[model samples]
Target chain A: MEVNHISKSFGSKHVLSDINLTFEDNKIYGLLGRNGAGKSTLLSIMTNRNFADNGEVKIDSEDVSDNDSKLGLMYLMSEVNLYADGWKLTQIMKDSESLYGGFDHQLADHLIQEFGLDVNQKFGKLSTGYNSIFKLILALCLPVRFVLLDEPVLGLDANHRELFYSELIQSYSDNPRTFIISTHLIEEVANIISDVIVLDQGRVILNQPVEDVLAKTHSVVGPQKDVEQYTKGLNVIGHDMMGTIRANYVYGDLDDRILPDTVQLSNFDLQKLFIFLTNQYEGSGKNENK
Target chain B: MEVNHISKSFGSKHVLSDINLTFEDNKIYGLLGRNGAGKSTLLSIMTNRNFADNGEVKIDSEDVSDNDSKLGLMYLMSEVNLYADGWKLTQIMKDSESLYGGFDHQLADHLIQEFGLDVNQKFGKLSTGYNSIFKLILALCLPVRFVLLDEPVLGLDANHRELFYSELIQSYSDNPRTFIISTHLIEEVANIISDVIVLDQGRVILNQPVEDVLAKTHSVVGPQKDVEQYTKGLNVIGHDMMGTIRANYVYGDLDDRILPDTVQLSNFDLQKLFIFLTNQYEGSGKNENK
Candidate 1:
């Protein structure tokens, strides 16, 4: 799937601007951004739920606009509940099968049992966590090449969230397909995602493999003076101070210099990187381009 | 605050069974449980939102039931929104001040600006994340001895959640109060919470200081044969196998003994410990009485 020069605006505010990205098949992509950072907007335009003011979306080199065949290949489980409130969980599953075709009944049944969800229950009566599970079940069972999930684990408990991740990995291994997961729980999804696309103020600020992005950033903690002197010229994104100790998160490559006995250096995870990057953009107007 | 032998049942379903716990002043407690494990029920009973079939809750040896003075000292920021839909943020804060007697308007104003929330906006108009932030601001600002936060970070993003944790630490340092935070995001609250209460199937399975609980369990990984030999007769809570490699998570004390060269050991986090304990109960009917 490809999004070409996608730009969107609501009144005078630009939600997304010239966002060009491509998602290759059979790889998991993490669509990450701060709140109101155009993640949902870009996804909506890609899935054709909302129209973009400029550019277009393509699937298999064909325009997705007004194209049922192309749209059929993609499935987006958004935060908003689109299903009718009157429908039961079982009925919703049947409806999805009828619309998408080849709904994996076996997987659906397995997930329903695993999550301990009552199929007879009404959609409106389900709790917040259960509501998320219901949508996730539908998304997983549907036979779609490209699946885009927005806040998939929004209300899921830790156990359920863990189960969902394992189940997702299981299903992906069984059937390789493109998945674009947009979520606020960065650490939970950090390991599962193959590539990351970070949006900031309607612009693509960072896009790279998870490992590569993590490799460039490091957290060096030690005596305040020594740490500051060591990271003086590095692209320091953020830092924390406690008593006389200091921890500086430095982005970009670090020089192969001898470290002090008291200092300790470790790699920065996705969550820390996202915080520092977005925090930098908000703080000092430092935006990195890909 | 203390809950003595609290038990509740609706029809034949026992929602809470003999839950006796105490919340000391000036400490944070992480109330953790799986779905349907009775976390919400316990919180409701503690806050007097729902009545327990037996036993009572007390503040300083005085029964909280029907005692306005005692109840006023505690507050529950629940998942269910208590504020009216038409009320603005400022109005809600004012209402809270009038009711609670000492709402910190300065702190509330600071939080509102920090989260980029508009006090003029109606409560219903706020987004999911903002709604959580709105409630969190009130929880932090209100001058109460005990605060019960149920899923406080429900719809929060990474940056906002991080901000909330830091602010919580800051406020707790300035004004020490008892905070019982019930949520499924264990890793996020692990470091912040002083103690943990793990409820499972209407029972309090574990309750202890964070450091003590973490010290009791460990995960040892190595070859299947070597790992099994080393962990023989040990309290193995959970184990996973991949080819010839095995990772066994053992609870209770690990003896100081020499291990195989390939075997490695590490601590089990709050989330992993909760999952294993809960899984153990459901799988083997072994409930440790600690």
Candidate 2:
């Protein structure tokens, strides 16, 4: 899917400002950013659920303006509600089969059994775990080539979240399709992503391969004097203090001389990277590309 | 807080079965499990919001069966309500102050500015990000000794979630309090926690210092043969396949042989550890302690 330079606003408040991004086929891309950074808006425009003030979205280099089948190229922000209130689980499977061409009833049925979801119960009253199981079933069962999941693991406990991750990765691999996963739990999803696109203040801040992103961001903890000297040229993410010992999460290669065995080093967790990058932009009042 | 052989059941469903836990003072513990793993059930029982089928909870060795105030604890489980729809932000603050005994008006006012919340807006109508901001503000304003947060980052964007973590760690440093944070986002919160507890099947599975847990867990990824041989006799977390190359995460030492230059290793991410530990428990149908 190709998203041309798009802009959106609500009256005078700019939500998405001149955004351009593309999702290559058959790979998972992590759509990341701080809250209110216009990720949802950008996603909305790409899926054609909401109109962009300017710009266009293309699938196979053809516009997705007014075509239902073409719109099938994408699915965005999926969560629970596999069956609404008073609806049976099997009814949802039927509805999905009717809506999406790629809907696989066999897969859905198989998943329902695997997850221990009762097909007879109304969907609204399912437990939180069951709700996530239902969403996972729908996401995996969808016929769409581009599946966009926004916070799909919200109500899920740790076990279900991991299940969803492994299942999503496995299904995406088997199907060979583009998957855009939007999540706040960056580090949790970091290792699974092939690519990542970070948005800040309604614009793309960083987009690169996952390993490169992780490799470039790191942190160091040690005595304040030694850490301060070693971190002179490094990008400091943040630091903490305890009496005299200070742990500074700096973002650069360490001068090993200053960082001995007593000091510790860790790759900056993606969530912190998100925070620091967003804070940098917000402080400078300038977007990365701007 | 010490919970002594607590049990809770609803109708015929046993939510919590003979659970006993001792949450230490001045430590941040991750109360982890899958959905419906009885985390919330156990928390509710400890807080007196829900009566246990049988058992007792003590604070500082004093029985908390009939006393709630002296516990000096504050619990925030996802969204309670800021009442923002019709009420002003100021009005919402006033309302929350009355409900929490340790409410600090000065701190509340300071956090309102820190989060950039609009005081004129109605409580129920704030944007999702601002709603999270409000909850964070409420959490910080309270002067409780022990704060329990259950999935506090529920609807937050990455930026807000990051800010919450930094401020939370700082708060713990300044106040020296016990924080029991329950969330599925493990890696994000790992840095802030001093200790870890992984729960599965309504029981504590892995509980120890974070450092101790990480010592036995590491991922060795490379060629399938090397990976297989290296992981022999160790607890395998999970493995992924990319053609002939398989990357396996294992729990145990990696010092048998010098790892090949092609093989990459990393300290076990907490999220992975949580998933592997819990999934292992569920699959084996046995508790580690048992």
Candidate 3:
């Protein structure tokens, strides 16, 4: 699937601007961004739930706008509730099967048993965690090639979140497909996603594989003077100071300069890298294409 | 502060049962639990916003019920909105000062500038993340000895959450006070909190310092037979299998047993320990007093 020159605006505000992305086959992508970064807007446009003001979305050279067969190939489990409030879980499942043409009843039953969800309970009466679980069950059991999950574990506890991730991986292994998950919990999904797409101020800032992104970032910790000397002229995105000690986060390759005895270099996690990258944009109030 | 034999029930459903715990002075406690685990109910009862069916809350050996002085020393920042919807940020801060007798206007101003919050906007018009930021500003600036924050970083982004944690640590350092933060995101708070209190099904399952709890847990990874053999006679809580490799999570101290060359041992984080501990209770459907 490809999103070519897509742009969206609300009144005078631009929500998404000339967004271009391509999601390859059978890979999990983490769609990440801060609040109001146009992640949800882009997802809605891609799935045709909302219209883009500019370009188009295509799958296998076929435009997805008003195309029933093309739209049917993708499933988007969003925050909006499309089913009636009075409908039970069973009724919702039946309706999903009818609309999607087929549903994995065996997988649905397994998920229900694992999550301990009551099928007889009404959709509106479920708690926040249960509501998320129900939507997740539907997304996992659908027979679509692409599944887009927006805040999949919104109100889930630690244990439930673990179970959901494990189940998602199991289902993906059984049936290879594309999964694009948008969530605020970056650390939880860092290991699960093979690729990452980050949006900032209605623009795609970073789009690459997880391993490639992590390979170029480093954290150097040492005395203030030594750390600064070693990281001079490099892409020093951010730093933290405590008395005489300092830790500088570098975002590019290390030079061949000999390391100081007082300094120690290590790898940083995705969350820390994300914080520095986004903070740079906000601090400068300017968008620099990467 | 002490919670002595507190119990609460609503329509034959017990929210908290015989809960007893003590909070030492100038410490940060991570109050962890699943949904409907009575964390909010307990905080409300402690702040005199709600009445308990049994027992009482005491500060410095004096009952807090209907005691203005005692209640004044502690502040509860809850999910419920206590201010009028039409009030602006400045008005809310002024009211807080009048009600609490004093407020840190300097700190509040600094936070407002850092977060870029618009003070002229009404309380109801702010977004979810800003709303949380406003409440957090109030909680940090008030001149209270005890502050109970229930999901203080509810909708905050990663950058904001990191900033909040740093400011919290700085505030605690400047003026030593007790902070009881109840949240579902455990890994983020694992390093910031001094101690941990876990509630499972309205019961106090684990109460210990963070280091003490982490000290007793170990993760053993190797072949299935070797891992099981090494963890034999220990409290094995959970295990994960990836093809032939198996990882067993042990809760108690490791015995002085010989290990195979292929086996590896390492310390697990707080989130893993919480998952294993909580899962043990749910899998058995029986509560054993620890």
Candidate 4:
């Protein structure tokens, strides 16, 4: 699937600006962005739930707008609950099965038992965590080629979140497909996602494989002057200083310059990288509208 | 502050049962629990926002219920917005200052600048993340001795969450107080909290200093048979197996047992400990009310 020059605006605010992205087959992608970075809007446009002001979303070179067949190939489990409040979980699943087709009843039943969800209970009666669990169950059981999960583990506890990750991996292994997950819990999904797509102020800032992103990023720590000297010409996204010690977060390759005795280079995690990258962009004040 | 034999129920549902806990001054506590664990209910009861079916909450040997002076020392920043929808952030802060007294305007203004929050925006107009930031600013600037935060970073992004944690630590350092944070994001708060309290099925399952709990938990890994033999007669909370390899999570002291050549012991993190401990209690089928 491809998002080509997708731009959207609400009134005077530009939510997405000429956004372009490509999602390959049989891969897990982490869609990362700040609170108002237009992730949900982009997802909505891609799924035809919302229309974009410019460009189009295409699957296999065919535009997905108002295209039922292409739309059926993708499923988006977002935080919003669209089902009727009075509907029971089982009834909702049945409705989804008929509408989407190819629902895995066996997997759904297993998940219901595993999560201890009572299918007879009304949708509105479930707690926040259970509501998230129910949506996750549906997303996993559907036989869609692309599964987009937005805040999939919104209110899940540690045990349930672990279970969901394991189940997702198991399902993916059994039937490989594209899974694009957008969540605030970066550390938890860092290792789970194969590739990452980061959006900053409605623009695609970083899109690369997890391994490549981590390989290029480094944390240079030591005396403030020495660390700054080592990262002088590099892509230092941000830095932190505590008294005389400093740590420069670099997002690009390091030079062959001999390392100073006082400076040490170490790999940083995805969460830290995200924080620094986003923070640096915020400091630039490129998009003051948001 | 102490919670003595507190119990609460709503109609046919029992929310909290015989809960007992002590919050020491100048310390941070992580209150962890699964969905429907009655964590919110317990916090409400402790803060005198809700009534308990039995027992009482006391501070310095004085009943906190109906005692305005004692209750004034505590503040509960919950998910629900208590301010009027049309009220602006500045007005809300002013109201809090009048009601709570000793509101630190300097810290509040600094936080507003740091978080990039627009104080002129109405409470209802703020985005989810901004709303959380507003509540967090209030919680931090308040002069309460016991501040209870329920899902403080609910909608915050990676950068904002990191900032909140750092700001929280800084605020605590500047003004020594008790902060009992109840959140599902366990790993994030694991290091920030000095003590952890786990509630399961409306019952207090585990409560201990973070260091002490982590000191006793071990992850025994090896061949399935070897791992089982090594962990025999020990408090093995949970275990995972893949083919021939097995890992058993134990939560108690080792009895100086002979070590098998194929087995190795290592430390487990707070999240792992919480998962294993909660899962063990669930398997026992105690209470089963929730």
Which model is ahead, 3 or 4, in terms of lDDT?
Answer: 3
TM-score of chain A of each: 0.94, 0.85, 0.96, 0.95
Task: Give interface RMSD, every candidate, in order.
Answer: 7.6, 7.2, 7.1, 6.6
DockQ measured for candidate 3: 0.50
DockQ by candidate, in order: 0.47, 0.42, 0.50, 0.55
Per-residue error at B133 for model 4, in Å?
Answer: 1.3
**How far does residue B42 in candidate 2 sit from its true spot (Å)?**
1.9
Candidate lDDT values, in order: 0.88, 0.73, 0.89, 0.89
State, as a TM-score between 0 and 1, how close model 2 is to the true structure: 0.79
A1-290 in candidate 4: lDDT tens per residue?
A: 99899999999999999998999999999999999999999988889999999999999999999999999999999977889898988889988988898799888887887788898999999888899999999999988999999999988888899878878888898889999999999999998999999998899989999999999889999998899888889988777777688888888887788899999999999999898878844455322211
Q: Give the deviation of candidate 4 from the true structure as CA RMSD.
A: 3.7
**Model 2 DockQ (Cα-based):** 0.42
Q: Write the per-residue lDDT of candidate 2 for residues B1-290, one digit (tens) a residue.
A: 78898887789888777787888888888887777678777776677777998989888888776686744465555555625468787776676667665577776665565566788887778876787777777767777666777777777777667657867776677778778888877777888888887767777777788888888777778888888877777777776667667677777665567677777888767777787776643444222211
Docking class of 3: medium
Instruction: Summarize candidate 2's per-residue lDDT along A1-290 as a digit string, tens digits.
Output: 78888999989988888888878888889988776788877877787878999989888888887877778767665542434587777777677767875587776775565556787877787876676677667777888888887777767766667666766766776678888888877877888888989988888888888877778776777787877776778777666666677766665555545556666778876777777777643444122111
Whole-structure CA lDDT of model 4: 0.89
Off by over 4 Å in 1: A255-263, A280-290, B255-262, B280-290
Screening candidate 4 with a backbone cut-off below 3 angstroms (N, C-alpha, C), the clashing residue pairs are: none
State candidate 3's TM-score. 0.95
As a whole number from 0 to 100, the lDDT of residue B137 in candidate 2 is 75
| Model 4, residue B117: C-alpha shift (Å) | 1.2
Candidate 1 lDDT tens digits, B216-290: 888989998889989998999887767677888998898876788999999879898888888633443222210
**Candidate 1 backbone collisions, by pair:** none
Per-residue alpha-carbon lDDT of candidate 3 for residues A159-278, written as tens digits (9 for 90 to 100): 889889988988999999999999889999999999989998899999999998999889999998999999999998878776678888898899899999999999898888888888
